[model samples]
Target: MPQSHPRPYGTLAVVGAAALGVVLAACSGGGPAPKASDLSSADRAKVSTGGTLRWALDAEPTTLNTFQADATPDTALLAEAVLPTLFTLDQHADATPDPDYLTGVEQTSQQPQTIVYHLNPKAVWSDGKPLSAADFAAQWQALNGRSSAYWTARTDGYDSISSVSQGAGPHDVKVVFAKPYAAWKGLFTPLYPAAATGTADAFNDGSRTRLAADSGPFTLSGLKDLKALDGAAVTAVRNPHWWGAPAKLDAIAFTPAAPDTRLAALRAGKLDVADLSRAVEDGTPVAQAASVPGTVLHRASAPAFLQLTLNGGSGPLADPDLRRAVAQAVDRTAIAEAVLKPLGLPVLPLGNHLVMADQHGYEDDSSALAPGADNATRHLDAAGWHLAAAPAGDAAHRAPAAAPVRTKDGRPLGLTLLIRTGSAEDVQVAKLLTDQLGRIGVPLRTVTVAGDSFFADHVAAGSFDLALFSWPAAAFPVADELPLYAKPAVQPDGSLNNGQNLSATGTDEVDQLLAKAAAALDPSEAARLTTEADTRIWQEAPSLPLFQRPQLVAVRTGVANAGAFGFTAPHFQDLGFTGH
Candidate 1:
């Protein structure tokens, strides 16, 4: 991606609004009135008195602290209720900045480097104190100070910022950065309150049970009694003093429903909206309910990609030929058609690039590893291994070595493939690959690891030969991919670099490309550079691209304007109850 150019936020906003308008128009026949099924008929008959809207969420908040939680999506969703971002992503993943929440941005002589944003004139915390820039500074400092691995990664965007200053007014704040950053506007999520500073350690710690205060559209009203609700649920009432658009529903009650229970609830007219995972959508109940006249099922491509990460550093995967052979051994087309297409459209191929087609950095030029037994044979043959057609047939064998039979470093090639235990699909894929490799005269072993240890301890430590994993792509830009593939660096405290780069493969070229693209202000130029970098990365094949998962949301027919934000986010704000 091109790194350096300047563009105004106004142009971006207009483009975003246009894109969203087009999507909304396509989804609805021109903003029809909300349906009765969207809200309870009893509630619809009542006056437009705002009140709580009970909601069911699958997971609980992992942490009350925003900066401390990065891996889990539940944390971000909860924080959205408490803290507001300067800009919100529309249904098309376009930036919709809230100027009312921000007074002005002060630019230093260094163009895009040091920007000091003034908060809204009347902005105040839930505790009735003015919110200032110092709060942001303190929060960032506290998060960085604690040395939590997840928080450190989340705050990586602010690593360039040198300092933050608070002026006389609580809303007056200044931010100084070490270098010019083009995406500075993207960093303005809500900050912590001043009271959090006193319990800084406790606030920054992910172990905290209750959050201190909120500054967004809703405050933590109360935790629901699971016994009464029959599931994990929470209620968030609207903040009366909210500076932005007031929430239509007075309160949002979240109820957790299992994958199976969701469809039944929707069929029984129990829920206004429900999230549909692939496992749920493929079942007969959901399929029948989706086709029903009174219900509207909208599906979109999610901004996430399932990937197969190759162990590139050492062990059996050190040889590029072996990796290529393994890549060719699997039938991705069949996987897509059998595993994913039933859920939604099989829109694009899983190319070498890790990003989905909608992402800014996506490059479609690359080709996918061809499927079938013949192609697999060719790859195995090229890697100096012969394929045996049957079990007892000594029909295939390896040729004599030039010197001695050796691996990448004149050693034997042997390794175990690791995958998460609970995922049946992943286990099936791993076993299939293992069988294919066995035919090519390569010994392979499969092992299942616990989910927590698999991602945290094993992958980071480079303990496995190959693994199946998924990576999320942000809607803003492709510049955010730095932490995943960048080379690990030693910390000041002599700790190992354990950001997100599980493979531990660091390329100077990739780093330079990403840095330049991020620094570029122009979207087109940045996109171009990002595409080039993506091409390079894909060709290298550190991670093999899998299918893109589709976003499936089932809403009552009466629900109006419910859709996804491009492939980026689920736009809950666009949802409203339609009267019958």
Candidate 2:
């Protein structure tokens, strides 16, 4: 599974930051080196080692616990450095065994969907517990969502497991699935040493400030409790017990800077890596960094897409025809062009709801069934939402001025568009939508909230007619995508099972195809079924996917082996300093 699920933190949030004054590559004193991307093998051989990397977390990672939804995007950085996963996706987005933790994985049974995992004999936790089947069993039980006391954020793969038991040896774990799962390779990933997950309290809140155990290439190096001062930050140093290729970097400092201040911090030598994905615009500090002494920029396709999930369960969007009309009236190309095209990226609207445009098994559902603005007006008129002369207002309010913002039956066609504030891209996109939808007699009022809280405040609650946000693609797309497009189910916490199922419009046919694709062992059948899933989702027009969100970063030249990871964990062991 080549899924990269970025949480509310634009995929990887900044956990914390204390601005320390420093310069760029010129200040760090590194000689000429490779490009900004991950180094080639030949190039890697010539690289130097042993230095610290200050990575900017886009937002403070709310929870270090990978089991919870609040974990920040950069949690992966800490997770990969500490906990070990059984398997990791490769550059090709295919599952590859992580030699440090897993020796082998085999499908043991077909009918009951049994799978066997062989743990590395030498793998041991920082607590001295041998990597055994017990850790897997504990993870399966705690994350299956069977216990009301367990506060797991995602139970996608775990929910399908029927049992997890030890085999001939304690290190051998056998998993029996009640239902077949396609991305089974992603299970028990970022395995917290059993010491951390043995109890519900520990599983939920135990790792709040610091991890209980470590087995990966790096261990906690400094203070866990972050303070206002630079010296008190939590840092990671090479783990002594790590059995794999020894980690090259001496240490990695987890720091945070306010999103707006990251580029400035990077320029002044306070930060080593700033996720300058959005900071590349003309006037931003990142844009000016090109002229600076030492700066390296890396760009790659993010495993995510931007979407407008329409809410059809209540309010003005409840009407199917109105929803369809809104879908048609939205100019997705303009949205992409305004933001992505300037960066030499694609402006094509992503038609597939599950896989990205660049991934396999994607189908162009938008151009096939989605209608245009003229057809949108026709459909609305046919549905009795007749356009009338505009209300008196200035050119700024010309949309409402040009047409009546309601149905003929006094059903007022006004709708609300909720978006995260501080995102220049989203604001520009929302404005484009407001202007475009308003032109078609559908008046949209835009509401902005903080980025970190946007999902909880509006998306999870299904509180708005329309919303704009991006979905960070999971590492296992088929196994993890169901919760996103499935029929809406409200949980005990009032949060939704599928927050993006805002319209509550997923069909039984779509669900069936999703399951079929998940279980289809045959590669061809899985692809076909996934394509069918895309087509079925296209028919409903519940959400409009705009484009693949791009991943871009500005890194310090002193660092090597730093760039976007497509569908796998970053191999921190290989990242080191080439500094003076």
State TM-scores per candidate: 0.75, 0.85
lDDT of 1 at 145: 41
Q: Score residue 35 of candidate 2 by CA lDDT.
A: 18
Q: Over the stretch 287-308, how does candidate 1's per-residue lDDT look in tens digits?
A: 6646644666666566565677
Scored by TM-score, the top model is 2
lDDT of 2 at 575: 75
Q: Report the C-alpha lDDT of model 2 over 122-167, residue by residue, as the tens digit.
A: 9998777788877888888888889978877667578889998997
TM-score of 2: 0.85
lDDT of each: 0.55, 0.68
Per lDDT, the best of the predicted structures is: 2
